[model samples]
Target: MTKRIRRLTAALLAAALLAGCGGSDSGSNTASYDAVAEESLALASGGTESALLPDTATGESAQKIIYRADLYMESTDFDAAQDTLLDAVDAAGAWLEYSYQSGSAKEQDRRVEYTVRVPVENYSAFLEQAGQAGSVLNLSENAEDVTSEYIDVDARITSLEAQRDRLNELAAQAETTADLLEIENQLSNVQYQLESYTQQMRALEGKITYSTVDISLEEVAVLTPTGVTFGARLADAFGGGWRMFVDFVQGLVLTLVYLWPLLVIAAVVVGVVLVQRRKHPRPPKPPKPGKKAPAPPAQYGLPDAPAANAPPQSGKPDAPKNPDAPQDAPAAPAETPEPPKPKY
Candidate 1:
């Protein structure tokens, strides 16, 4: 009976060992299979695939294109051309995002710049219509394909949204205050990213839906020649030179107009200076070289007459007079000689 019990126990031990080994192997296989299945499922659903991958089921996704155009044009009749351009815009169902008009009819440099937004469907038609409004000086177009970028942004948005939902669930099931707070923080971050990505997506959509066109319309006296011939070039050169001369004259006139106040002030100053000079005349200058100076005038006065009470003078010497007799005759005294008459 003891031997039988031992045999039974060994059998049971061997069976238990075999069962344990088999169970471990099965568990490993199941684990590997589950891993492979998860990977296959992820690939089938495109969950782990690159966002830039082209869609296979739909053949290919529609291209996301952002179109922009720049047009520089000139027109002789500015007002009429402007009217035409506006009509075209209205016809195309486009709106002017920005518009600026400068220079006036008097200036002869009337210019209008328009930043127009047109529906993508009307982009080509609008360009054709706008070109008709004026002579095209320059035209440029750009088409940007944003398919990959669009897909990337969209995928990121979807991921962030899913993460937000998961975080919300986690927050609700959180056991501890700290855990709940952490999940809420993650949730907030996910929400913020989602909002940012959504905004970006909307902006991109707007750009794709509505193409932008920048138009510059300038008033010109002559249309630019489209030909590359020498004659055309010569004509253009002549026209440009003439226009330059006219512009210079116009600029000078405008400058004078703007400085009229200063001109008036300067004129007043000059007039005042002239009047002051006239009021205060300068002294006469010296005689010129080789010219004689005027002589002084002679003075006129009466000549001195002979002294009064003088003896009579003769040509011959006086004879010796008797002292006594002479005294008696001298007493009568010589007649006073008359003074010489004054000359006029």
Candidate 2:
């Protein structure tokens, strides 16, 4: 009986060892299968399987992508600066959407909007390049990883595609046109869902791949003024004002000076006219040649005075004047007396 008990104990030990070996083999096989599956799922080149399709996937996980950047630059040459900015964009493989100038001569501003395709690995490098375009005044950068949302959207797309394929197969099996129409309507609905998901995916992809860059450019002004200063400027302003005032006064004086000749001519003409008016304006007629002027009559029956320059006319004319009978003059004198005597 002791021998029998020992045999049974040995048999039990062997069975237990066999069971343990089987358990070990089963666990090893399961581990190997999981590893193979993980490797296969991680199909992307040079990437881990988990990176492509994460352990946890959902519809809302991979739908959001966030990226933004803003920078400022200064350059002396606007065109060259703009060219440099364009080159930077090209280097970054960005889309130039908008650019423009702002402000006046002294203060000018230039701004450019570029939608840059920032490779997930090269976002930092892209920003560095953009900053090298000019002197950076202000810079801002932001990023958000949407690995969860992306996984979610991908899973939803897979499910939707499977549903659509199934609907297509149902349409193909339809025996009647009405059945086909119903299947088609269901297919259409699936397709619409697929389209909506596709659009959302594309938008999410755009947000992930392309980061927005808002760049502002300012022209560097060399503070070198052409020797203009406070005192000099003030002097210039005062001098300018004084010159203007002088010019105005000179113009007035010149205007008055212009009338000087006219005033002089008028005064001369008036003086000459007045003098002529006061003098014999019309000349007197000349007297007749050799004609004597009438003499004044003797006053109160007095004998006429002798002319001062006359010759001594002789006594003869006075005696003939009436030494004879008529006292009035020699009258008919003697002849009259003789006639009277004859009558007696």
What are the lDDT figures for the candidates, one per model? 0.70, 0.57
Stretches of candidate 1 off by over 4 Å are 1-59, 228-344
Alpha-carbon RMSD, each predicted model = 22.3, 33.7
Q: Lowest summed-lDDT stretch of 10 residues in model 2?
A: 15-24
lDDT score, candidate 1: 0.70
Candidate 2 Cα lDDT to native: 0.57
Q: In candidate 1, which residue pairs clash?
A: none
Model 2: how far residue 238 lies from native, Å? 26
Give me candidate 2's TM-score against the actual structure: 0.43
Off by over 4 Å in 2: 1-65, 103-118, 220-344
Model 1 clash tally?
0
Task: Say which candidate scores most in TM-score.
Answer: 1
lDDT of 2 at 317: 56
Number of the top lDDT candidate: 1
TM-score of 1: 0.53
